[model samples]
Target: MNIYRHEMRMSLRSMLYWTTGMLVGLLFFMMMFAAVSEEASVINLIVSQFPSEVVRALGLSTLDLSTVLGYYGYVFMFILLVASVYALKIGISALSEEIRAKTADFLLSKPVSRNVIVTAKALSVITLLALQSAIYSLGAFIIVDIITGQPYDKTVFLLINLSIFLVGLFFAGLGLLLSVSIKKIKSVLPVALGIVFGFAILQMLNQSLADPVLAYLTPFAYFDIARIINARAYESAYVISDAVLIVSFTLLTYIIYRRKDIPSV
Candidate 1:
């Protein structure tokens, strides 16, 4: 319990910063929807002139930007990217910090076993993420309501926002697995950004290529906002894929973290 509280306290500031940034950015984007809606015809005409491949790669192909939901869908892509980064940073740093700070010896010298340590840290990360998701979702809901001043489909909005949480979880799992497997992570930000952006780039390529196989390779492609908006629910296949990724990586993290030797300080 001490470990869990410590870990959460350590990450609390970071979580707050990310939450504030996302909230402000989302609200600002939502506010712009009105201006965009006022000039929808002109904006659509300009967007139509862009290459179809470019539009698709941007995740704007199937969306109608005039509606609040459609604008939210487009903005959701950026939100997911930022949220993934936040999750990746938390996961990568959770275990690696002890090693990086040369404090693993101190931590391991305690009465608790390594498994307990890991469990506590993992729980802390999960708690932080849950808080972030809930706050962001609530803020988005309120902002959208204020901006649109019309009733939108609550079911669809919830599903679309849920993708942010799921994607964050996937990246968090990936980060944990990588942190355990790698010998050292000199700096968390560069590696996390590289991995997140690399996969994001692959997603863009997959869209450009229209390749079903490539789509499976990137978590960013796992939740299609267009499909979610259209179906009013997440696609079953991708949801299953997300589950698989999260479960597989989480198990692997525990296995490797438990068995791996901590370097002597």
Candidate 2:
């Protein structure tokens, strides 16, 4: 419990800042929805002139910019990207912070077991993730309502925003595993940024190639924003894949962290 409390306290400010930035950015983008929607046909036509693969890669093909949800879903991809980076940064930083700061020895001096410590760290990250998702989603819905003054499917809007939570979990899990697996992490932001963008690049390939195999490589591809708009629900296979990968990463983190030697300052 002490460990959990400590982790949460350490993470709270960073989480709030990131969530606020994302919300503000989303608001800025959604504010343009009215103007964009009015010119949707011309924009869509210009988008169509590009190669089909390029169009699909940009997600300009399926998502119509004419509707409220369509525009939200389209621009929301940037939100997801930022959210993923934030999640990964915290995940990598959470466990690694103690070590990087040369405080692991002091932490291990406590009576609590390593397993308990790992559980606390992981749960703290998860809790912050849930709060971040909730805060931003609520703000998002309210913003859209106020700006558009137009009715959109609440359920689908939610499903679209829910991608942030899912992607956060996946990256958090990966961060924990990497924290335990790597011998040294000089800086987490660069590592997190690189990895997230690498996967995002893979998502571009997945979109362009339309490959199921490539899609599995990137969590960004898991929740198809456009598909969520159309289907009004998440895709089962990708959801399952996300669950499996998160669980696997978490389990591997536990196992590796348990027996690993802790270097003292």
Candidate 3:
């Protein structure tokens, strides 16, 4: 419980910053929906000039900018990217911070078992992730309603936004494994950014190639907005993949963290 509270206190401020940024950015972008939807043809024409490969890579080939959902889907990628970074940072820093701060020895000296410590820290991060997602979802709902002032597919809109949290789970789980598996993480932000972007790039390439096998490798491809909009649902295969990956990452984290040495200052 102490560990959970400590982790939450440490991360709460940064979570607010990221959540605020996403909400404010979403508001400002949605405010332009009217203009964008009006002139979507010109924008589409300019975009069409690009090669189909490039268009597909950007996920622009499928989404129609004239519609509210399509425009929201396009911009939602930015939110996913930013939120995943914060998630990865939280996951990677959770267990590793004790080592980075040279307090691992002190923490280990407590009466609590290693498994209990891991549970507390993991729960804290999960709580923060849920809280952040719920807050952004509410803010996004209000922003879309006020900015568009027209009825849209509320279900699809929600699924698109829900991707932020689902994809975040993948990143957070990977981060936990990385935190325990790696001997040292010199700086959390750079490590988080690099890993998140690397997977993001892989996702873009997978889309460009239109490869089914490659899609399973990256979490970004799992809750693809274009695919979601077209099918009107999340793919069961990807959802299962996400669940399996998260469980695997978490289990590995527990095993490695328990056996690994914690050096003293």
Candidate 4:
């Protein structure tokens, strides 16, 4: 409990600015939804003018755009991108900064165990992501509900939130692994960002190549937003793959971190 509080305090202090910025950015996108929902002609014009590929890429689809959920989902595609980036950023410093700042030595000098430290940090990251996601979803829901006056699928909405949350956990584990393996914290953020963007590009390429087999190689391909909308259920393969990645990375990171020579603070 003490470790959790300590780690949560550290994470919140570091990430509060980014979380606030994400919420503000999400608000702007929600406002755009409000504007577009005011006119049926505008929605028709958009659907007519936009290419099907473009619409799918942007997470806009053959759904009724005037409805609050559809509009919120449309705008949320971009917000998701930002939120994912923020997740990577949070993870970059999760363990890497402790090593780089030479604080790991001081912390370890205490009675805290390595697993406790790792678990506490993991909890902190998950807690931060949940808080940010909840705030963003709540704010958008209120804005959209007021504009459309209709209740949508709360189950599906929560599913979307959970999917993103799981993805964040995957990235956090990846970041922790990198932090343990690499000697420098400065390299953590760029490497994490590169890996994420690289996965996205692979998903795009797999689509271009027209290969279903390739979809298994990347998370983005399996976790398609359009499919998510149509099915209203996250792909089980992705949920399983993410679970594997999280577990694999967590174990690997713990092993490496335990062996690391901690420098003085």
Please give the lDDT score at residue 121 for candidate 4.
81
lDDT of 3 by residue, 7-80 (tens): 88888998999999999989888988999999999999999999999999998998898888899888888888
Give Cα-based local distance difference scores for all models. Answer: 0.88, 0.92, 0.90, 0.70
> lDDT score, residue 255, model 2?
95
Q: Please state every model's RMSD to the true fold in angstroms.
A: 1.2, 0.8, 1.1, 3.1
lDDT of 1 by residue, 70-169 (tens): 8888898888889999999999999999999998999989999878987898889889888989888998999899888977789999888877788988
Query: Alpha-carbon error at 135 in model 1, in Å?
Result: 0.5
> What's the distance in Å from true for residue 26, model 3?
1.3
Count backbone overlaps in model 3. 0
Name the top TM-score candidate.
2
Off by over 4 Å in 4: 34-66, 187-192, 206-210, 263-265
Clashes in model 4: which pairs? none
- Superposed Cα deviation of residue 61, candidate 2 (Å): 0.6
Candidate 3 deviant stretches above 4 angstroms:
none
* Least accurate 10 contiguous residues by lDDT in model 2: 256-265
Ranking by lDDT: 2, 3, 1, 4
Which candidate number would show the highest lDDT if scored against the true structure? Answer: 2
